[model samples]
Target: MSMFSGTIQTLEQSLNYASAKNRAISSNLANLDTPNYKAKDVTFKNYLAKELSQPLQAKRTNSKHLSFQGEAQPAGYKTIRQHATSYQHNGNNVDVDKEMANLAKNQIYYQALVDRINGKFGSLQTVLKGGR
Candidate 1:
């Protein structure tokens, strides 16, 4: 099987994405008191779409087979600045309430992904044990 084959790969990617998003949200919350600090976020959908759009090449079994070129997988998340309207007079855009909500939501998502991955591994273990 290919390296990126199954729900496990997707779940791993999602966990990484959510972790990165959590960091970004935490950073925004951290700098809420700093002057002129802009909020930032890492959205998984856009990044995941871009990654999924890339064509994964198959391994050549024969020497005479044509070689395929593909882009390397993303190593880390890309955080982008949030450019929405600011409510603070100091030009800071970090909304504490919204950040807290996002943090909670992200935690739930991350936990769900981890649980799903664990389930996948458990299923694999069952198969290996001959359903014992």
Candidate 2:
């Protein structure tokens, strides 16, 4: 496959994940004032791990070659996750501090993912255009 295609595909996946995470964080922030509002988050790592471990091919008879792990394209992301039960005296399950921290972390991760995609494009450009 072309380098551009690969980069585009990866970027699309990252963008999807970041957007979903943003939605989750927004929901948590919005429910801060709501009573017994448990924070919700996707099982990102678990889903990703299972996706990674899945076999790509239908069936391979030979055991000599390296077994394929997963598919070329991602199975996409999911926003469906579990809720965190709140134990606060105020009845508000939303923890502002924790949610804020999570938001910051997600922001950083989103930026990093973007940077990596940018780097991929940059490398392709460098390869295409001879050095000055």
Candidate 3:
């Protein structure tokens, strides 16, 4: 099994991704009036695909192989600008409505992830207490 096979780890990574996306969306909303400020977004689909495609394969027979610990984590997210649509008269492509909607969606997702993580910890605590 891979190190990230743990549900807690997955939730942690999701929290990070959501946080990054929140920052990007907040920035776009903040610069809605700035001239030529294109909206930016952080996509994690590629990272998810890469992580799913490559499973952990570790061989700990020799000393050299022992040092290896699964495959490296997926690369960081890339904040790409939204150049496909321009809702405002200026060069800015940030649509206040769309950004607000995205903000709400991201918040919901972030809360879900946090709840899941808390649930996992709660379970662990119960187990540690010998079902008390």
Candidate 4:
């Protein structure tokens, strides 16, 4: 059964990206007033572009022939780096409103991706149960 193709892989990657973004936003929000604290975010678009551009090698698990797709994913979130931002008082360039908006949007995207994943699994289950 051919499964987990391009968009599906992209969606899965997006899931992790959004999750990491949520954490980054949370961290910035928590340090709202801390001095010299810079806002941080994962370069999700950049990472996604890189992932999409590369030819996907079949991800493997313990055994060679036992090809479990996406079983061994790359450690991506560790690549997140801080970038320069607009100056502000309290040494914090973390814009709360902007971060909040981004958080909401990322949440919606994450939820949509999760729904799609669930739907795919549900369809698989139905097929396994004799397509009833």
Candidate models: Cα lDDT each: 0.83, 0.74, 0.83, 0.74
Name the lDDT value of residue 39 in candidate 2.
71
Model 4 regions more than 4 Å off: 6-9, 49-83
Instruction: Work out the TM-score per prediction.
Output: 0.72, 0.70, 0.75, 0.69
**TM-score: which is higher, 2 or 3?**
3
- Global fold similarity of model 4 (TM-score): 0.69
Tens digits of lDDT, candidate 3, 1-132: 753257777787788889999999999999999998989999878877887676565657677764433575654566788888777788889989988999999999999999988888888788889998
Candidate 2's C-alpha runs over 4 A off are 56-75, 81-84, 88-91
Give residue 18's error in model 3 in angstroms: 0.3
Ranking by TM-score: 3, 1, 2, 4
Candidate 1, run of 10 with poorest lDDT: 68-77
RMSD for each of the candidates: 4.8, 4.2, 5.4, 6.8
Please provide, for model 2 over 1-132, each residue's C-alpha lDDT reduced to its tens digit, 9 standing for 90 to 100. 465656678777877788788899899889778766677774467767777676674345677766665564365666663444655775667778887998999899889988888888788788879742
The alpha-carbon deviation from the true structure for residue 90 of candidate 4, after best TM-score superposition, in angstroms, is 1.7
- Comparing 2 with 3 on lDDT, the higher-scoring candidate is 3
- What would the TM-score be for candidate 1 when compared with the true structure? 0.72
Give lDDT: candidate 4, residue 129.
Answer: 98
24-104: candidate 1 lDDT, tens digit per residue? 999999999887899999965676678768866656889998776675475456789977768699989899999999999
RMSD of 3: 5.4
